[model samples]
Target: MRETRRQTFDEVDLLLDNARLRDELEPYRDESIDPSINRMPLHAENEYLASMLAWERAPALPIAEWFNPPLDLMPPDSLSDAQLSSLLNKTIERLFSKNIVLRCTDHLSDRELYMIVYRDILPCCEKMVDVPGKAIEWMCVEDTETWLRYYASAVERRRYQEERGMPLPAAETPPYRRQLPGQ
Candidate 1:
């Protein structure tokens, strides 16, 4: 899929909101670390990773439909603001919306966070967060940064293996560098 930095006017608001949310969520991001590198790798489940991989391949459709879709089909536009908000919140929660639990704490590397956010969080956010047009550009930036890190690590691993003349032993563990958010 083509990498893009396009953002609509409304996306600016979404971007700001997302930044704020990130700040609020930061304190609660993952803090635990696995000390034993010998244990099975803490790979995020494959289905979650697969979903993120699929997103990379899918055409970039307008995020609107995935966000605040038209409610004409549901016929509840006339509800009171409080009621509507409550219902929307429920919908958002049920849709697996991104929240404090999903944010990346300093504990996880950027790549790990990227996998968690894009795979587990973004898809859920699709039905919950009303993304601003500008945030789309930010998302693009984040996505690109994540991809580069993944690519770099893979390349480094292959290089190490070639030089060592053996499949990478545990000591060849690739260093995990956190990709800066939206860099």
Candidate 2:
């Protein structure tokens, strides 16, 4: 009963939030997607609009800036193989703390993975959403090769074959497989 009541939207709050969202989103207004297609009730409609506003107004900052204690790392090229391995483990844990999960990573060496995080992932601009337990899985490699060889399920492989009419890569054990921290 308490949970259900908590989930119920307050009418006054809904209107206030919706108005604020409209104002914030005005400068970045894009009418590419028709809002009328979403037939949710008033409260839900406001939530959908609010989410859109969140993404629109989200600052393009480094992932380090997303955390209260900045997640700083040594330059990847400066580290030896052993140091890189240690830093990579620590980095993966820190990323998981912010619900950033690395996927399709078993194919790369420790240095390679760390370099990707330092060069590509950390500097990349993304929405720093604070949704609890909802992880954003970052695909670490170029999508097609690793995904086709290791990650894609049979159904997905068949769908790709049917859709693209291309030969599927044979599935193989990812060369550097090991357990990482859980999301």
Candidate 3:
């Protein structure tokens, strides 16, 4: 008869505990993927701080194995992918909720907000579409009939910046300002 090591429920529980321990150790394994909880305002008795300190002081940690694992150590390619997916999902959820709230408020028609968000605002946000995390961009429509009225606000802003000697975004030189070499 061959003797095999039979496992009990307690051993199974112990294995679960070990797996939990590994899960707990996951964040420390990757510095870049680690959440930056430091941005939050700190209190003397903050729970976050206490937990962070406690995590810092664990003994017999497989630090070397955790930090120096092979490329296939993680379940997926990178935690960045997880973070990006999380952000995009959250943004979509938030946007849906916000649309619901806006609809209920009756302050602005659904069509109005839809036009701004889709046509104008989304174009500006194209610059940030590649960026990680959630950001809401809005566009405002100006009702100006004449050229003077249309450009008055922009002119004021430019003049104000000029007067204050503030560095404004580079403006393209007018055709008149471009002197020919023979001139």
Candidate 4:
């Protein structure tokens, strides 16, 4: 219940919590943790240790299973455009609730995004991290054309072309734009 950021080395709760976390993280210790955390205050170090332990313990499961009863979607072809759009919005909300974010989505149509969520995202196994504000950003677009055009800026495209020695796709407007969550 005290203020968070200025936590001094005097608090018993923090010290106790840190002790527990240190023991729990002993087996899962990263070689670089000591050097990275050496400069931080004990409270900050405790938080870092806890997050590392949380990630270490997180289960790799299909994203849909993060939902209670698991999120099962009907085939995108089975639904009309309006139906698909409505369902997609609701599904995005559900995914956001479980800390799963969809990125690079503007390039695809409603049906295309919906199918990706159904076929690609839901079944894909990912670490369900317990860390707050740490969401899994799932990329919705697979096409390089879409990435170069809508997502990347002209300068970035040019740099990418130079680096990869490949033709850059001309940048263009994405067909469908929605005010989706966690954009």
Candidate 5:
């Protein structure tokens, strides 16, 4: 009789199991998931869970280091409207090229967005890990008081009242809209 060269049924099952485990972990093995974690015993039963645990334990890095070239932004007030607009366009393009998208761009006027990009985002050294399948988002990070006072729509203000159980204050017109760039 010819000697059999086939894997045992149990061996095939183990191989399939390992493959499934790897597939489960595949989405988490990106740049944001620190590679320093031990990934030995490729056939471990809990490999997927281990990878997630390792990611949770990884040290965070500053957002500035996440970019190939660090952002060096100028003060919004220092630039003329024309210069600011030009720089804002270039900066937005640069950020988009790096998979860093600005959220709520449509909600903000040119000057508001420009101030946010210059003062809050560029100067921010916060750690913002980018997980796979999720875009890095930059948005207005102003205080709730300032946002509610200036930018919150009537609907948003009412929603905030219901959520916080606070008495709804009379909506005051934002004084900055008159000075909005390109207005």
Candidate 6:
């Protein structure tokens, strides 16, 4: 008869415990407690875990401190169209340099985007937590309905529709398309 070696359940349990211990030793071990962890698919969970790990190790800085020269934005109401345009362009460049990016900007006009930069973003005193390989996001503030209608993914739109118990209005593309950073 041939000799055979079989693994016991206790041995398997020991192996699993070792694996769990290794995961706990990782930088983002605490992120395992994220409520959506179980709901996400394997790949998405992996990505999220990686992002969480990066965030855990990254340095935190205020938005004002992120820039070397510091920002000098004019008040929205005081700027002419040409001045606003020039400032907006320069600001966008500066934001991109600092790994900050705008999301759902396609829903807003150029003027609206500039206004947001002048009013909401420039004046805000929030600290940015920088994660490697992740760009800080500035999403559209006004006209959320328009963003949801045109820019939100199909699944999000469907969920919104279901929650409201009414059909959503058709998506219409915005008149202007501002190129987002790190496209």
After superposing candidate 6 on the true structure, give the runs of residues whose Cα lies further than 4 Å from its correct spot.
1-62, 126-130, 142-144
Which candidate tops TM-score? 4
Off by over 4 Å in 4: 1-13, 30-34
Highest lDDT against the true fold, candidate: 4
lDDT for every model? Answer: 0.38, 0.80, 0.36, 0.86, 0.61, 0.68
Residue 154, model 1, lDDT: 69
Candidate 2, superposed: residue stretches over 4 Å from native: 1-9, 32-34, 67-70, 129-135, 178-183
Q: Where is model 5 poorest over a 10-residue stretch in terms of lDDT?
A: 174-183
Q: What's the distance in Å from true for residue 112, model 1?
A: 32
lDDT by residue (tens digit), candidate 1, 1-183: 223433444455555644564455445445332234224322322222233333444454322234455221122445555565455445434323322222222344444434443444444323232322212322222432333333336677667667777655332222443333233
| lDDT of candidate 4 at residue 35, scale 0 to 100 | 76
TM-score: the better of candidates 2 and 3? 2
Better of 3 and 6 by lDDT: 6
For model 3, the local distance difference test gives 0.36
How good is model 3 by TM-score? Answer: 0.19
Instruction: Quote the RMSD, in angstroms, for model 3.
Output: 21.9
Model 4, 13-101: lDDT tens per residue? 78898889989988987675677686788789988988889888989999989888899999998999999999999999999998888
Tell me how far candidate 6 lies from the true structure as C-alpha RMSD in angstroms: 7.6
Write the number of the candidate with greater TM-score, choosing between 3 and 5.
5
Q: State in Å the error of residue 101, model 2.
A: 2.2
lDDT of 6 by residue, 1-183 (tens): 223223455455555654454485475465455776658655455556556555555555546556766786777678888887787878888988877787777766667888787667766655454545767688764665776777878898889888988778787776667776677
Over 1-183, each residue of candidate 2 has an lDDT whose tens digit, in order, gives 876666564666777876787787778777843578367676767766666766676677888787777777899889888999998998898898878899888899998899899888888778887644457798887978678888889999899899999998999878899687662
Clashes within 3 Å, all models in order: 5, 0, 0, 0, 0, 0
Task: Report the poorest 10 consecutive residues by lDDT, candidate 2.
Answer: 32-41
Clashes of 4: 0
What value does the lDDT take at residue 92 in candidate 1?
Answer: 33
Q: What's the TM-score of each model vs. the native? A: 0.21, 0.75, 0.19, 0.85, 0.48, 0.62
**Looking at candidate 4, what is the lDDT of residue 9?**
42
